[model samples]
Target: MTQVHLLDSIFTRLVAWSIAVCTAVVLILGTLVGAKFEQLSVDMQEAAVNADMATLLDAYRDGGQASLASRIDERLNFRTPSGNAPHYLLVAADGRRVAGDLTDWPGIDTGEMTAIPLPDGSYVHARAVDLPAGQRLLVARESAMDEMVLNEIGIAFVIGGLFVVLAVGVAGRITAGRLSKRVGRINAAFKNPDERRLERLDRDRNAQDEIGELTRHSSEALQRLNRLVDAHRDTLDQIAHEMRTPLMHLDARLLRAIRTAPDDAAAQGLVDARGDIRTVIATLESLLDISHSEANRGDPRGLEPVDLSAMIENIADLYAGSAEETGHRFEVDIAPGVTVRGEEMQLTRLVTNLLDNAFKYTQSGGTVCVELVAEGPVLTVADTGPGVPVEDRDRIFERFIRAKGNHGASGGSGLGLALARAIARRHGLVLRLKPTLRGACFEVRPESTVDAG
Candidate 1:
């Protein structure tokens, strides 16, 4: 009684079909039963008429009116086809009631030599008679007292149809519910690979149904899709990382050559061309690395123990001369002996990118602090200059991401942080921003690490 509609679901379709079946059954059965009932009534009426004719002929032969009438009444049995006995009556051509059963008349027509209603509200038709007497005999049967056969048959048919429909509906609902549960489980597994509770719904395709086959195919499809995405990501990261180092070396050599060249105009022009070529190569490599890191689907790098504290200090020392010449305070506080497991070159690049970004954003006289600390296995870099805005902090770490007015002011490919993060992940480290009111803090965690000594 939930009022399921025909179009709602597959279960509804089944229910609708069952209803249609029942309706058809009822119509067919009703027609057959009705026809049988009519046929039986005609047969009974014909039998009664024949019996009346025989009785009338016998009366003439016996030559006894009273006894003949009595015989006719007894032979008719005064009972209708429905089995409810009622009195039998006869009306002669003289319009006089002869010796018979009923006295009251219920207005019946006896004509056409076919079954007809008599005056006693019973049905009768013609019977053979002696023409000289101008008398006709007829047999009458009561409609209500006739057989009640079709009533029970109709009831049985209706009950049976109802039971069949109910059984079908229940079966359909159970099947649909099971299908829904299976689909839900498969979807959950696809969304979260870490959860392995879903059954191998996709493993088997032997079922002769469409849904079963889909389940089997979908499992393979999802796995293949995941693999492809991962491969693409790894390719992008590899292109970016491999290209950056060589580009740096090329740029450094170009600038060195330009500085050492003579003051001739032709020599200067060659130096400028080399610089331009180096810039072009660096740009192309940076763009690719940015694209790859943003995908976050690549294979991570190999990990090795790195002296992160010393790494930070060394970078600071390398940049200290410029900081002093520019009248900027370059602070360095790297706790000694802090070690992390990561790709050393990649981790160095990560720190270097952050330092370069800080130097670019801070004014010449503004202070830049580089502090490296190891907490357990976590390495944190906190800088102080004009810290990135809350809105721009996360975006700045992205490749080709530059702050307003900082574009073309520096010679970076804008993929340093992106590549750094990629390398960190490859080494199985989590690199993220630590909340700070100062410049920026990028923290990297090694899988197995210890505090700085």
Candidate 2:
């Protein structure tokens, strides 16, 4: 897994997009409402001013124009009977100034209430009406207070919108983080594709959400797949057990026929047939060994701390006669007390498989070296032969797979290294091909690659 940058994270992107949507919505709605605030404020102010205008018009109708003049003068002086203070304008049809505080008609749109600016750099909301005899009556209120309150409300909306966006971002972060963690657990479960090693994904199994359902399905699928794999392994084991008897009987019959052959040539043919049967038996046994190791990989039940140094020395001694027979120089570099917890027989087979490959692949007079070190308790077996191609390094560890460009020897059944790797993994270690300037090198190290079964 690699570190994801903040901007690259889907959670961060969602948060940013959410904040953007919130801001856009707020600004759009606020603009729509804000554009109407001045007019809306004017309409509210019109209610009070219109009532005052009605009273003055009633005065003019009941007690003549003189009574209206007197009322306007009293209203300007704050002495009017009206509860609200309002400014006024009255004009004749000739544009003659009627009784009012204003020097002239402040010409503006009429009928509906609208905002108007006065010379003092202040706003007023006013409405004009046609009176009798072509007279025009205008009513207005100074709107500084209304504008102040509206400005404050706009500021509040902006602050509130920012807070809402922040809250949304926090929520998005938490939700995204939780989802990422759940998905990460699923990834960890399938990280190892090996069916035997892959863990079951079983988080939130009872949950009704998508991830929970996915986990449930994944676990079920894994169980079915593992069952099928176990069945297949059982069938192979049964077949190997069934075949071993016939191969042993055939080998015995060939041995008996070879002793009673009519001549040396007839005996030689029997010997070759026996050798072919023996090869088949060895391949079948190797397959069974690999299967057993893989099935119990990481099981610590029967493991013992075996001294790797002594084990390598013993195997080397066993191969000493073969080394002498082939005129190959056998080199040993064993670090004493290099011990590891493992099945002794499986561990011994692991050593033998690597050494066998070395001896089988190397030419006469070539060098085969075995090394064990305490640092990793690492074991290394190097041979002087045509080295494995870089591309085939990993493939050669697979059962029945051999390097395409080898030293002209079809390494027997090609399961030696595969079985070796299986045994190493069973003991919670890693067996790998080491890149060497000389012939092939195989290494088994205390590289923990498994957990307890």
Candidates in order, TM-scores: namely 0.51, 0.58
Q: What clash count goes with each model? A: 14, 0
Best candidate (score: lDDT):
2
lDDT of 1 by residue, 317-377 (tens): 8989988887778877777898865557666777776677667767787777776655655
Encode model 2's per-residue lDDT on 1-453: one tens digit a residue. Answer: 345687887777888899899999888877877778967876778787788778887988988767888888888887533322467888888999887766667777567777666666666777888888888888877767777777887898899889888898889889888877776666555443244334435545667899988877776765676577678768878988799999999999999999899999999999999999999999989988898888766545578888778888999899988889889999998998878888899999999989988888888999999988787667889998998887787788998888875643554688988999999888878888878898998888865422210
User: How displaced is residue 56 in candidate 1, in Å?
Assistant: 5.6
> Whole-model lDDT, candidate 2?
0.80
Name the regions of candidate 1 deviating beyond 4 angstroms. 1-11, 48-64, 72-83, 101-132, 143-147, 180-199, 203-209, 252-453
